[model samples]
Target: MKKTRYYPFERNRYFYGKLLTVRDFESEQKYFNDKRRMMNRLLHGYGVLTGLQVIAVDDKSVSVEMGAAIDALGREIVVPSPMTLKLSMMDGFTNNEYAKNVYLCIAYDEKDKEPVHTVANSSVRSDEINDYNRVLESYRLFIREDAPDPASLPLAGITDQTVVIYQDAHVRVLQTTPRYVNPGQLFEMKLRFEKTLKAGRLSFSYEMASERIEAIHGATIMFQEPQEQLESEYEIKVLLRADSTVNVKGTVGVKEESAILKLDDCQLDLQEQAFGEIQIIKEPVRERLMSDFVKQSLEASLESPSEPCIYLAKICLIQMGPTYVIERVEQVPFGEYVFNSSVMYRLAHSAEYRDETAGQFVTKSKVKTLAPGRPPEFKVNYNPAMSELAFDVGIPVGGGGGIGGIVSGVVDIPIEPFTKINVSPFGKPSKSFFSGEIAHGLGEGNVLILTSLEETSVDSISDMLANGERVYGGSSDVFKGSEFEPEAPEVKIGTIAYPQKGTFRIGVKLQQPSEPFDVRVRWWAYSAETASSGSSSGGGDRLDEALSALREAASAGSDAE
Candidate 1:
């Protein structure tokens, strides 16, 4: 979009004993007038300043009220009285097949006339001749097929002479719903008109290129009951079912009387199911062991321990089909070293030991010797009867004759498949130690363990899971197996209303013998007289003052010349 450029004025120069002609005087007057017009264009811009409302006069004409505006060339246009425009006289109305859009516009015009003036002879009685160029400003109103572009209007040519004030398009399609759809889904298309239809019946029909997709219901919709009272909007719904996965392509046609209007092509895709796989491991894949420093510290503090030592273990159980498998096991260290002597003695005597070479516990003696002669050994076992995994750590205590007794501490962890658990030391606040889906079906993807001090955090995590979002925290925390990615949905569905602003456009097909309609136009006009004195008008005020000074100086120079 380009605006008209006004060049700086070159006024006539005056010198001592110089002759001035009619052309020189006319040029001098033009300089001041051009300066003022240029100021109006730059400072105020141009649009309908007030009134100029378009109202429907009848089925074939509309009336425009009196108003004022400034054209693109900075010429003021004012309408003194109301005017009526007929639809039949508008351009492109006779050549249109279905409906024609009409635009009402106004343009600036001027005329020069020579008026007869009688002059009386005074003293000398000699004939003196004088000529005057009397100019009259006027305006012209007309109707056209296209609306004028305000920024690119012709200022110095006759091609485009008017600025559009209103437009009227009889019918429009508001929206189409569910552009993407699953198999056997329903689709809807909605349309709106400027006014109620006078026809008795409206029919709907569809055509599809693919044989897999078929319309089960609403294929041919008919609205015939009380046609005189039909609404401005009509919604056509079609139930389409796809026999196989494919892209559905089709078009819908609406028929009113003898006229038929075909809509744009409709595109839809059928969604397919995506499944994931589950892998079960018979043996443990990973193990987390305690540090040597933690082990030595626990044994050293057992000399005069006041409380029982507590051992923490984090275990993850994954469900495959019916049974569950222990995928990972981690041992956590106790922050402080403490032991119960009496409790340790009972665990040391009752706990069974496991032989590392046999992969099973020794049956003959409940106690197994460690390091050929030393008494310290770990006893690990899983009991199905109680559904618990127990671990016993023993240390040797010196005696009088080189025979020492074993001091052992036991930690029993409860295991319930697919359930969360909270763990803490005795007399300490409980914290979330395990979280997983309870009774989750055979389908498998990955297991995620989220440990936090607050239990309420689970609500937000559960919401994410429900929304089909992947909840894997990181590589270390996620026990990944195998998975499949789901397909994206194809169509979106919604509704839209009329008189909207922005780049979104609506299309429509009108019935035969289309009715005349009128549109309400909204315009913003800025002028120096109507401008307010406020913070918002500060910049405008400064520009107005500067332009006023330039116009005054040009007027003074033109008068002196």
Candidate 2:
């Protein structure tokens, strides 16, 4: 069958902290008859994590800070100033801080999950590339004045392998350069000197005092001494391995919540505005969807004879925030959120036209008897205020295809079979809450989960920028196999929870969350033999017409009324 998809961009409402807001939707009065504007019914709540760093100087001062922004969809969210840096010095400094010998310092967060670039054999270390690497910061003397002219001092020349010293009438020269170095090596050094004097010339004597040199920057340092302060140019390089690995995993679970989901009102209507249509892959047939695709595609949909009731299935949901389980109640700290809902539908052909079609072409569903059966009933499990939940209701077995036959129960059909809320012989039905009573919806499948996350970082007195990827799960599909062209997911924007640090975002491995939720869904099973008309709108339509049908089906029992 030719596939057709309708996604109405209107009549959609957004969830704001468990409360539904109309700001995301247009009113029905202004809506038009847009058939292409079908509703997106699969629930979505995925979390994308990125990071940033802000610099706060001397604990209180707004020094310079920097942050890197990444997104889960593999996009670089430009952070104008992820870090705020200040060029001024500390308060107590009065030239002494600069005039005196100075030492370089290093500091950085030791978070374990950051994506690191590993260096092999002759590759340069992280300190050699990224300037922010804390390994270059230290208390080692960075500035010295042992040279005849203070301006002649070597600062950046032999950064990791040199130091200077001076005495009253003389200066000492200690060279700690190694002839050869390898990947896995360390070095150190130490030297001393005493001064000797000569008159008239204002001269001084120099000697190689101490001769102990250690490893420096992964290589052993062998300093050569000279009679006078030796002036030499040298370079010390380091090679570090950054290829790191750790375990990563995510799961969904059930827990208790202190508060109940309070759904003030949730309305879904076909808005007159039609944004456009979408095309997706599907199973070869309905029976194949359950036999093969069901276990694989956690969220999918299929067409049926029903015009409005699309058989949306397996919409997996992942909770979007921190969740706690106390006393079996799940307490999720849900913030500004977005969710997805999806369903499948198909247009039916008239009997007059079907009779003229070639039997070699398309087939139809096996019509079953509907002599008066029971309806479904259920109970509410979780709070309605949740950003999303699962809703599935099917028919029960026995009683000669009673009222429950139309629901989640198995029915015999041929050729390209049709999917239904009816439970198969051995298949399990997804549950939900619907009608005045608590029960499952008319569909069976996974509930899609979607949400936004803010990066969390540890505060430091001297360290500035502290932005990182937001850690959250979402249900959107990311096509990673397409080599010709790439696709992007919904790019959501959010404010950082903390102030000091600059904003940053990055893509994450975003996995699905395992949280269980129950919502109500009202389903109806109509006879395929029945004609489609306003009078027989199916479930509620036959209501007023079937009082005796209701008598024998009072309490809306599955088979016993």
Candidate 3:
């Protein structure tokens, strides 16, 4: 005889919001701006309060109250706590200092059939330290469109429209039970879209984007490479299961080389469900930032007297895990700026306050001039918001002076990239910087990688760890078919700002154990030290070679067996 039970799920995941109460300031102890707690707060910390809530729960459906007019329009919309009852909010990153302020997030997977908010994080961040405060103010925090703090836009045609947008996109399901979902688990699920989507215009794509569900909460939405990208028109697809809910608006547009659909307003539902058995799956989470996650120093030209500014960006593979936070991205301490104009001005400086933090730091510099101009070379600089990586725009500062942009504390990248290497407990990550050959390319022998490693030269190892990088060395274990016994993976981990000298070697190498296994290496710059005056000519055409190498390696080992 066999026994069977029914478990129901839904198609939507939510992004929560936080609330601020009168008691918050007292509890905060002024750590919101403190640099000391930034690291812990960024990774393990919570915002001023709990995460923002987007929906309310009922017996049959999840009732959502969209943020009202003038506020919460284009940004990641979040509203004040809708309930008046005395509530003891969930306490994942919560420190009592932020008393009374309610936090929201996908509070609980409103759709999980489990009994607990297992789909969400319950540990709160409570610190009034430096690094901690900086992290809080970085990535997810934005003032309401109507708020007085500035940067918010007016919602004439956009405000009320977003409410409709939320309505058309969100759904209702039971609160996700506090259960662990492993890969390959299946369950019955349901949903109710607010608007009736057209057939052809509506399409769906299912993906197992976020591979690390055991550690964080939420899911990385996946969508199809749309047919159009610049138009206002959009398509929606309802995934029956094991797929994605893609929103297609506009035609295929070229963005960063690849064909991708673009839209000012887009919402995709890449519902990642836990396969296998829930009871057996432990949430896979890496609580600390990897060596690659650090602020690199930069030297850019400044046109005016303003607070030091830096540009940073990191490419994260969206599916690494559920929840992600930028723990730290401190600017370099020194740099140099060279302007060609007759009125040459140079500015070189370090952190307003250094010698006070823990993470490895870099120096920064900037130069501006109006003399006969020439294109500038590359340089590294830190970006507060994108803590783990950095970005260097090609069109260097020119035309001399009308005031370039300057961010106050941390700044968010304009768009979240598809892939980014987050911190992990497994080993050092981002063990290499994609450069030297045609700027950056993913190739077989051309690309540097660390399959797994146990050791490196003393200087090499220290250089990486201090910078939060992942490098792989080699060992005799490659033949043993065991762990990486060569002491280091074959890959060499490094920062975009600094590249190694001499004929640098990569870390350990290994063969893929499964079919269609893939990986990526991107071009990154964190400081002036790592910047290059030259550009990469043809790099995108090499991905196949990289994959083939890993595949062949695997085949050789399998044949030996």
The number of the candidate with the highest lDDT is: 1
- Each model's Cα RMSD: 45.0, 41.7, 32.0
Residue 316 displacement in candidate 1 (angstroms): 72
- Candidate 2 deviant stretches above 4 angstroms: 1-106, 109-174, 179-561
A best-first ranking of the candidates according to their TM-score comes to 1, 3, 2
Give one digit per residue, the lDDT tens place, for model 2 in 1-561: 212333333564436575543443334322432221222112222211122222223322232222222211111223334333221243221332211211111121122343444444126564543222222211110111222221122111212223333222122322232222222233223233222211011121222121122223433222333436322222222222211121211111111121111112321121122111111113222344345433533223322111111000111111223321111111111111222222111123345465665343322223222222345433323333442333334343334323432322212211121233334367643222111221112222321111222223343631354332223222222323543111222222211111122111112221222232211111223332221222323565454444334334323332110
Worst 10 residues of 1 by lDDT: 447-456
Score candidate 1 by TM-score against the native: 0.27
Per-residue lDDT of 36-154 in model 1, one digit per residue for the tens? 76766545544556566666665556666786766655667777899876645644344332233334556677776785443543234545443345877867655443323332332
lDDT value, residue 228 of candidate 3 = 59
Model 1 ranges off by over 4 Å: 1-5, 13-18, 85-98, 114-133, 148-561
lDDT of each: 0.35, 0.24, 0.24
Q: What is the lDDT, from 0 to 100, of the residue 112 in candidate 3? A: 21
**Poorest stretch of ten by lDDT in candidate 2:** 307-316
Candidate 3 regions exceeding 4 Å error are: 1-377, 386-455, 459-485, 489-509, 512-561
